[model samples]
Target chain A: MAPTILILALGCAYNEELPEKDILGTVIVPAAAATRLQADGTTATDPRFIGPIFLGAYSGIDTVSFGYPHPSMGPIVTADTPGDAFPYGGTTVGRYDFACYESLACKVVTGRFSDYNDMLEYFGTVLGSPIQDDNGADVANGSTFQQACYDYFYATSDQEMAFLGDLDFALNADGDFEAAFVMPHTVFVEGMTIWGWMDAPEIVPANPTESGGFSSCDVSTGREFDQYDENFREGRVYFDALNTPSQYIYAGDWVASGAEEAVVNSPDDKPVVRLDFGFGVGEAE
Target chain B: MRTHGNLALGALLALSGLASGCTNVRDGFRPVLTDAPFVYDIGELRVIGAEELAGVDPSTVPDAVHYGQLGAGENAGLYGGATFQFRATGSSVCVVVDPEAMFWNKEISTQSNTVQYKFEDIFEDDGDLDLSAGLAAYYTGSPGSEIGDFSAVYDDPAGVEHELAFNECIQTGYFGDPAHAGRATVEYCDIDTSLHSGVMYTAVLETFALPIDDSILNFGALAFDGRCADLPWYDSNGALLAGASECVIPNEVEYADANGIPEEKAWFPELERAYCSGVGKVNTFCKDNPGAGCQSEEEL
Candidate 1:
């Protein structure tokens, strides 16, 4: 039998028994030691790799032209890499994780961090923040000029703080990240563990300035190509496939390299896709 | 606090009107009334520091008007230009020429490192006192964001869009006034739970003259051959009222902190109402009723 896959949610209380509002949920399935019935009713053995199975979907994705500057990876993409623009067709482009697909509906694991700061720092590291822009300038210069700029940009008379706090509360507490991840339904890992988790794919374009014929390109900085195209983003399906019993999938990508044959290896492989169906914002699930 | 300062600034502006008529005599300068009834053609204004707009549809705008970048700001993108026309249809009534077409641009970045910002081209950054009051009100209230869909409320000719749903009316009030002078403001929004961050309260008043004869209402606009340039939005009180405004125009940003939660509908009303009336017009009905134009503190 497949190891029972459980879906866990993050960012809320577990005891209150509230409807999962965060819009993100996780599931656990059979690992190397088990097998789950696929949609086709065939049972397949779990595949093992150095990193989590979730990361396999986002491997080798690029990050430049997605908004923030691309991180430094040897022989990969970066901002101002002598390219016209990222082929995604926007001033900014990048990838992020959306973990609420129907495929992630097996066993669940759950965990929580101490506070918002811990979550932000951990998420930033995992999502890749403090990355140098094309000019090698990160946001944390802490220079007098930068501080002065920040001061003027955020003038004293403006009500920017209140509005911002409202946004933070919405994204953190009311956004419902917790309910989907708590208990046996989800898995809880330390913030450091998430930061140290394997990276997402780096998706580069065959051409830099122009659209690369394909609907999207997944960037390795863990930034998927869906954000640029409205249609692709709407159609995104995020799934977590568990291989090892105690493992969580962090990053993966659709690859032209040997991944296709690997995905179709077994008769019982039920591929999972995690879909973030716009929680409390747009297009609700 | 903003009220007293605004009153003082209003008095100063009234004084400037005495000497404004005699200065900068132009051939086109006709005898303009204290409250001139004329259609102010809103020129092309651009959004600053924006590279892309998420939800705004460019094709929604009609092709009759020629859109230009107003030659200002850095990398403002296609969603940059906003044009609005305000005409005094009656004695003191300024109805938006095209209410449906009236649009403002807003940008909000969830990343703390990248502070979200929106800018309106309303002449000088802080040349006249009215400009400052007008700008502060705009940022704090009018522009609203539904999750990532940032929109500027076009109800007021001088207002900026605010993302807060609960206190939308408060924003309309704070930035609704077009009379105060000499202020330009930018907001660095800290996403903290406190109403007052480490930085709080900014007040400045620079007086400018408005003639009582046939001419533009604002002297600064007259100097530039009629244009206010880029204006800002929001102020201290207005920010508090965003929760109040959200009662009417519900947005995704407002739903983040759902109702019944301690943080829901929480705000300073004294500041909200006082600031709304002092700066903005007297709501939808007051503008409809001629005698009800300006409301005193007690009457409101």
Candidate 2:
């Protein structure tokens, strides 16, 4: 007969339960850059890194152009390379995991991201600070630059700690990633091992010149495609893994990478981190 | 705290208005306040770096009345162009336009580390702002992704066929991606056309499609010459283009967030009545009036 092991209940409890009003919220990172309480590899989704990745709470969806050199930004078939533009009639020329459709079931749709003021508001509200921010305010101005979140995924105005890098939160149907969800703080993955923890921001800039067909205009690094050096970045590194040699899927600038989350140690083990969906502001769920 | 900064910027823009009228407003340039809505088409603006656009003047750019292909998307492929009709009867000027793809999924990648990246764009090896400090200055928006079919049907001026959906309002969302600038209301839209008395003026639309992903396109159009380029349907004389300046139009506008249902009758307060609505997306208007313009269950 198999032996039964019954353990005592967890003695720890969260400081406070997040309120439901913080619906504008979504979990950025389940836990800080560490293993969940489930230890390593003891659960179903560890080691290999199976994730129900959290794509922070956003109001809409969009698709920006690819970043090939100016010469290749125009109509084409498929994106032969990362720096080149994709063809106009390619069979699957798209990015972004839209959890919603026109049926009005989910909250997703077409939109743009060029409004400077709107971007600032997004970085402030959606990408709340969890790291460290003295100002505790949104840092989106072109001049007054500041980190918005901490390693744990909460709002912050200061950069007290060093930022980490991970793979971009993306996936497709095969990996059960096509259907995305805005996870609240209730998602507890404290001790579980996290494979692709994000330590940096994923700032995928567009091609530097119009010669490539499309131009990033403002989000560009000013460096021409001829001068594009993968080893060295012209701007801040958002997605750390992307800066280095990696096998992520991308046509022009749209990247779709698969990232997963580790399951819990046992059904009883609660998340070591508190459920702070809204960071320090907004109503917490 | 951010509100104060916005107010400061607003004040600064207001002051700039006093000096030659080059002040940039969040919604638009200080309202020209002409007899008819000043129409302008940003479609002709080249897709160049910020440095390239630095010396550009709004008036110098293209408008719906007269615009060039601008070489980049001149050929009708991914960066193809579309045309809209601006028919005005009496005092009503109705310009028909469409919105394109919101999000794009990149195609499967091939192993090609052979090509290298240019270090001259934003920063260099060590990390220093280059001559083009604000190269991305013109890059103000972000991308939006949806799980469903966010497709549209686009018919260009030359009888060409394309797919697109009408969208201009940035609805409040529950999830977000830093890569996105929030759902694009429209690419730096403007109205530069002038309205005349009894003389019928047509604010022709020049729409363009740029492939931002493997296949998905960024379908968008802009009206120039200053003619109320605000909602999907509107009348320069404030009588709603087709019927009235109804906040909710058909097949033209779409709100992303379902939870953000319309509270009142579309964005009536923002548009028509107040007419604060402009080229960008206004989800607040769609709230409570999702079916404001729907004729029957078949229309929805």
Candidate 3:
């Protein structure tokens, strides 16, 4: 009887060692950007405004362009439209008409195409002609048409692939603004890419001449791609399967390194990834 | 037989241990309250004007328009702003009113309005003068043609006069038109002698408006007890004046202590009113007294 009881106790203690299937990490922002005054007179340190930071894991799926309706459909495919126009058929496109469809497609296509001139040439060919936008202008196959399609798309595909999460920075015991996130273990599998942004004001000046104090990227005047690139230039850092030497990957240099080297293990064994804005050094204790 | 029994006992013990461990893991996931990054101690004053459908065409106004607390959600109230006049004696702190102090909502075009004020913003010294005690007079009036002379005067024990300005008024372009003009005044005060170490003082909020007799006439006042003190005026015989009941002062200390919760706290007066009206969350005050007016929560 004594031996049976001892065995039961040992089994319970050993079961506690089983690993949790989640990828744990911390996001660090420069003190200057976190403390900068927002338009509402409150800084990112305030919880109300701290939720702009987004993190998403991609399965390397081509969900943006190839997954939706064919480009020949002119950026808008409604439920009533013929199913043959879309590659995957009508049920997948939902009830999206021309007006609502253009905004989403433009944002996704803009994120996928990095170069401004290259996007102009590519969209100019694929987007059909005589597609009148909301302002009653012929936007097909023109630079003005391509500029209209620009906005923030977090992942490579629209399905959110493997995981999508948002981090909210709050004043910790040490009074520093910090956010933490946990991704699924499947995100570490091969052919998966992780990307995110702090959704904060531009840390570095966009114009070469202007200096001092951060400024928000103006999207209304057809500067969506510039704003997207500015967000990446502010800071980029990620943890892959390979445990590569963690460092900042600025705008033009960022590439989605597939998680071929990721090691599936407990959160305790993984190192924390820091996303730092150029203003100051951020550390995770 | 003995060997077989020992092997069976070991297996059973291991299974029991593993089951217990799984329970412990699930228990760890239970949520517990954490410290909030910021805390706000808020006090809300809801002023609902009575139905005023005299001069204007009643057919043009919607049923919901007459109610002071408009909109859908819990934060909805009279959509205008008020000027809180704070007068203190026994202290030389100059009370400066920020021009942008009024919280106005132009959506509702009625005389009803709700004013939400934070205790820390008014009393706490953020490199400014710290206010102890006196009188907090809140003056709110309906839409008038031009800005009126809305002012208050406070006399301390030493006979030195301190004039506090309450010059905030809602102005409309149609002042000359009798159909759109009306007179509705909601005045209340809060006096807490125990909270601050200062001399007792009396203050008055006088509002002057254009004479437009045909507009809707409605006057409604609601004051929370313990937090509200009546503005008392006595004759030589030391008798309370006739209109003393019309004014109620807010006790700043008790107001803060009632609504200030260190971990995750927010108080909505609309929710309290709904609770008092036997519709929403069960309030203790409303529960104890069946028909108690949904005064703002004295202790949240």
Which candidate comes out best when scored by lDDT?
3
lDDT of all the models against the reference?
0.21, 0.23, 0.26
What's the candidate order when arranged by decreasing TM-score? 1, 3, 2
List TM-scores for all candidates, in order. Answer: 0.18, 0.18, 0.18
Q: How well does candidate 2 score on lDDT at residue B257?
A: 17
lDDT of 1 at A218: 24
Instruction: For every candidate, give the share of true A-B contacts it also has.
Output: 0.00, 0.00, 0.00
Q: What is the docking quality class of candidate 2?
A: incorrect
Off by over 4 Å in 1: A1-25, A28-285, B1-33, B36-39, B43-300
Error of 2 at B56 (Å): 21
Preferred candidate (lDDT higher): 2 or 3: 3
Candidate 1 local lDDT, A1-285, one digit each (tens): 233322243333357653221112222211321121222334333211111222221111223422221211222111222211111001101122221211111110112222224323322232233222223344333243233333534544323311111111011232221111111212211110100122222212222112111122122223222323211221221222211201222123111121222121222233222222111211110
In angstroms and one decimal each, the interface RMSD of every candidate reads 21.4, 18.2, 33.4
Tell me the tens digit of each residue's lDDT in model 3 across A18-66.
Answer: 3224555554443543443333333344332221333443332222433
Q: What value does DockQ give for candidate 2?
A: 0.01
| All DockQ scores | 0.01, 0.01, 0.00
Which residues of candidate 2, in runs, are more than 4 Å off? A1-16, A19-261, A264-285, B1-32, B38-300
DockQ of 1: 0.01
RMSD of each: 26.4, 27.8, 29.4
